[model samples]
Target chain A: MDFSSKLLENAVYEMSQLPGIGKRTALRLVLHLLKQPKEQTERLSNALLNLRSEIKFCENCHNISDVAVCEICANPKRDRSLVCVVEDIRDVMAIENTSQYKGLYHVLGGKISPMEGIGPQDLTIGSLVDKARKGEVKEFIFALSSTMEGDTTNFYIYKQLKGLDINTSTIARGIAVGDELEYADEVTLGRSILNRIPFEGSLKAN
Target chain B: MDFSSKLLENAVYEMSQLPGIGKRTALRLVLHLLKQPKEQTERLSNALLNLRSEIKFCENCHNISDVAVCEICANPKRDRSLVCVVEDIRDVMAIENTSQYKGLYHVLGGKISPMEGIGPQDLTIGSLVDKARKGEVKEFIFALSSTMEGDTTNFYIYKQLKGLDINTSTIARGIAVGDELEYADEVTLGRSILNRIPFEGSLKAN
Candidate 1:
């Protein structure tokens, strides 16, 4: 599309570079910012720049943090021995919101996706293995998604932690809590049946 | 959702302020940016800042531009006596892309909508009237949307130019090009039938 102003065009181009935003959406968003108060734009620019320039990662877990170590990893009450492995900080936030998991997290940054040229070395798996080899973690939970890339990343980490004397497990895959049985997929339904827990144990979970 | 870093949270908050972007999408976009090179974020920030702080609007048509007068208005070949009134630069761009209208455009910036607290006073109706009073424009084509607010805006402008000896017409409402007649809406079908043009005129419109 032809833009009347080079500034508007540049802004739209930059915005469309983001994931899921197309040229039309980028134009709408840029025009929206233009209509809003100038301070809004300034704040947004400053916030993004500050985040990029000053942001830090937790030295231990590689999760985004403001300090050398993140709050979750620094908390003494959180189970240091039980580490949940995730694709990114978003997963860490999701698990934290559940309030069910009290363990620390190891953010992998991303899954192993050969199609996207993201190899196992691109993730923080080496640091996680190093942590396991140091005998700090007693158990590791693979809480990544159920996609092929997620499975590959999990398997890669598992292989790295081989013979490390640490218990390894994956999050349970099954029908959602409120979903009907008939709607569940075949693989998930079969896995749910094969990995059935005690009736009282299921009752205790809620 | 809880963010480990305050800067990250601020960035996501600002990003979510854009129309249609929610917290989850904002987090995803922010994380995507964080994963990219630092220069990418810097470029995006600078582009937005530059657009907001240095952007200019065409003095003649009120379209977004880098100069005092827009390219269409500066062109001597464009018909100055015939003006097409539109809601914004997007409409101007759309009409320009069609290459069917050789007339100049007068962008109203927005339509009159009481529901959104927008009135004629909030738009550029006064400037359009001032231009009309100068006897510079002989005709005006109301190219706004067919919505209630668009009609209201059109009627308001018509009232403002009542005493002037200028012709006013609206864009035709009918089934879209390549659309099946059976699927056309009743109102549009009726309007199309009522406003039918001569066969020679229809043939020439192609």
Candidate 2:
């Protein structure tokens, strides 16, 4: 679309560069910012710039952190021998919210998506292999997504840990609570049945 | 959701403050930015900051501009006597895209929405009235939305321009191009039938 002002056009172009935001939505967002006080825009710009310039990741788990080591990896109470392997920091937050997992996390940064030109080398897989070979970890939980890329990454990590004595596992998948049984996909339903937990195990959560 | 890094949390919080963006989407956007190179985020920040700090608006039409006056207002070929009064700059762009109206525009910034505490006094209605009083405007086109707020604003301006010998009109409303007749609402259908144009005028566009 033609823009009357070059400044407005530039702002919209930069905004549309973000994932999921198209040109129209970018224009709307830029116009909304124009209507708001300059202080609001300044705050947003400063926050984003500062985040990019000053952000740090945990030295051990590669999770985002303000310090050399993240709070989770630095904590003494967390199970150091058990590491939950995740695709990104968001997954670590998700598993942390559950309050069920007491182990630390190893952030893979991303799954092995060859279609997107992201392979195992593009991630922090080599460091995970080094961590496994260190003999400190006794169990490695593959908490990545169940997609093909996620499975490939998990298998790659599992193969790397084969020479070592660490046990490997994955998170469970099933129909979500409050969802109708008929709406569940065939693969998930079949897996839910084949990997059914004991009645007492399901009863323990409530 | 809890963020491990304060920088990431701050960026997400600011991003979520934008209209229609929730915390989850904000987190996703921030995480996507984190995955990208630092230069991309820097460019986005700079563009937004420059747009907010250095943006300009047209002196006459109140449309976004890079100079003292907008391109349409500065152009000598436009019909200055005919003014298309609109709600904001977006409307000016929309009308310009049609390429059917060769008249100048007067942007009111917003409609008279009492629910939103917006009145005629809050907009550029006074400037439009002043222009009408100058006796140069031969026609004032009320091209605002058909909503109650839009009509109230148009009428308020029309009242302000009382005794000024100028024609007043609104853009016609009807079923959208290529829209099914059965889907047209009763009020719009009735208005379309009542304000039916001559067959020759309808055929002139094609």
Candidate 3:
């Protein structure tokens, strides 16, 4: 039967609108939340309500922060000259978890997809160019995904700062370490071959 | 590094507390919420906050509702005398989705799990027994799951209402449709054999 409460129905409808969620799953989540203590649910509610209001985009790197500058942008130890540009804050967290990179980051907000009507102007690319123009950063790392739109966006951003002395680079696209050669896809194998480094004991091939 | 904002950190912590969610996934979900429009995020926050204050448990059937008595309990067409007792509101929704069971429902909050420190006293069992004692319900259907705890709960409830004239029945334990005999687990096969119905063929006897 149809749900009787309009408020509960509304709650489920809103939850269903979230990514990777359906009406049935949303109903389950909403009911689970309803079963919790008022204090607990209220805390979650207040946190979500104040999320955008209390947080603002970092003026320097465009990462999310409670202040004008994000922690990564404000940190002194991080390599300010090497900046990694990504599509969203989640990508920043993904790279941070690796602990391999010690540079700052720039969130582009989204990629360039003409079909979806999302162009370079829709992203934070203009601000990114302005950041690079400040003469502080020496390298611009294109850490966007390997999708076509991601590549187009990267190309567009690279061209914007081509006239400047800043060196541009993209993340590697190849088979991971310890992976079998037979299992590698054509794209990855081709990239690895194109960007090949010297193999052990290989006399510099003429 | 630690989160850029305390509010963001708290939001991540709360989201991580949900089942099957971790710190990384929580960050992704929170970032996704932050990327959405301000109005959509506000709607989600308001829905979560209003859930607790707006909804209340139905005193009669113990189902979640905005009123004192839930819609199912308030309905006159439903078979109130044939109550389908279940462990939680999720079970109520599952049964309601079938549309075959026209009877009303009684949610027990949870099954009898003594090891988890959950006992009959901790549940709404007393209310159920009291309802049974009133001699209004003609049959009590135990629509619990087929887990160890479910069986223990079913047996306990069966013993409690042994002397009562009301007919009591548990859901059947048998072979499911489209199940392969070779693939069926021994326990399921054994239970199915034990609970088997009479053969229809004239030459059925071996």
Candidate 4:
């Protein structure tokens, strides 16, 4: 594709570098920007630059924050002794939206994915171990996905926390809330059966 | 959706304003940027801002350019007397990719769309008429799309150019090359049949 203007070409090139964007879509976006008011474009650029450059992370949980510690960590109402460990900030947001989990969170940043050259060291595993060793937490919930890398990270953290005066647990694995029982995968169905909760326990949420 | 950081929320909001992007996809893009090096984000921001702030257009054809006149309009090898009137720079690039035309071009910016509150005055039709009145062009090729608005814009320009010494013709309306006849839309097939070219003319391109 030919670009008559170098400035347009440069913008399109940078936009297409993003995941899932192609040259055609990038061109469409750039042209849309050109058609918009100059202030709109400036706002977009400013927002991105400000977010990237001036962004701060929670010193304790590593979640993005505007201050040294995130709101969750700073909240006195949250159960600081109970921490939910997850893969990223998206998971934090997802769990937070449910409003069921009243505990603090520890964002792992990502799981241990050897295929992606990501190791436990690349994540917040070491910092989590430090917290675990300090014995400030009563329970650490492994809330990562049930993928292999998630299991590996969970096991590695569990091993690190073993005999360190901390209790370790994982979120239950079962068919989704609205999923049909017949369509549930055999492995999940079997696990759900083996880990079935008391009949009265299932009635608590409602 | 809850955001752990206000900066992240602002960035996602701005990114989601692009056409075809939604909140979920915008969050994904913004999170990906957050994980990358600061330089990558800076490059993207700088490219978009610089393009929007410093972009230029061809003075004659109104095609996007870094100079007063676009390369096509400035090239002496191009046929100045044969002008192709197109809707926008994308059409110019499409025609250029074919490499079959060596003529200059006039970009109309957009078609006549009453539903969208756009009309001839909102476009560059007056300048195009002026160019035709100057008597520098012997033939004007109408290369607009076959949509209703495209036809309206075409007829509007044709009316303005009536009684002028220059000849006016439109690009042919027909089924695309390699299109299956059975699957082709009814309107396109009907136009293709009505505007069927002479057997010799059809045989010319191949």
How many residue pairs collide in each prediction? 0, 0, 0, 0
Q: Give the better candidate number (1 or 2) by lDDT.
A: 1
* Ordering by lDDT: 1, 4, 2, 3
Native-to-model Cα distance after best TM-score fit, residue A131 in candidate 2, in Å? 0.8
RMSD of 2: 1.3
Q: State residue B24's C-alpha deviation in candidate 4, in Å.
A: 1.0
Over A2-39, each residue of candidate 2 has an lDDT whose tens digit, in order, gives 88899988999999999999998998999999989999
Taking every candidate in turn, the Cα RMSD to the unseen true structure, in Å, is 1.0, 1.3, 4.6, 1.4
lDDT score, residue A84, model 3? 96
Per-residue C-alpha lDDT of model 1 across residues B53-129, encoded as one tens digit per residue: 88887888899988889888999999999999999989998998998999999999899998989988989999999
Q: Using DockQ as the measure, name the better of candidate 1 and candidate 4.
A: 1
Give TM-scores for every candidate, taking all chains together and pairing residue i with residue i: 0.98, 0.97, 0.87, 0.97
Q: Name the candidate, 2 or 3, with the larger TM-score value.
A: 2
Highest DockQ model number: 1
Error of model 3, residue A53, in angstroms: 1.3
CA deviation > 4 Å runs, candidate 2? none
Off by over 4 Å in 1: none
Fnat of every candidate, listed in order:
0.93, 0.89, 0.60, 0.92
Instruction: Report the C-alpha displacement of residue A152, candidate 3, in angstroms.
Output: 0.9
Task: State the TM-score for model 4.
Answer: 0.97
lDDT of 4 by residue, A1-206 (tens): 88898888899999998999999999999999988899989999999999998899898999999889999999999998999999888899999998899999999899999999998889988999888878788999999999998999999999888779988899999888999999999999999999999999999976
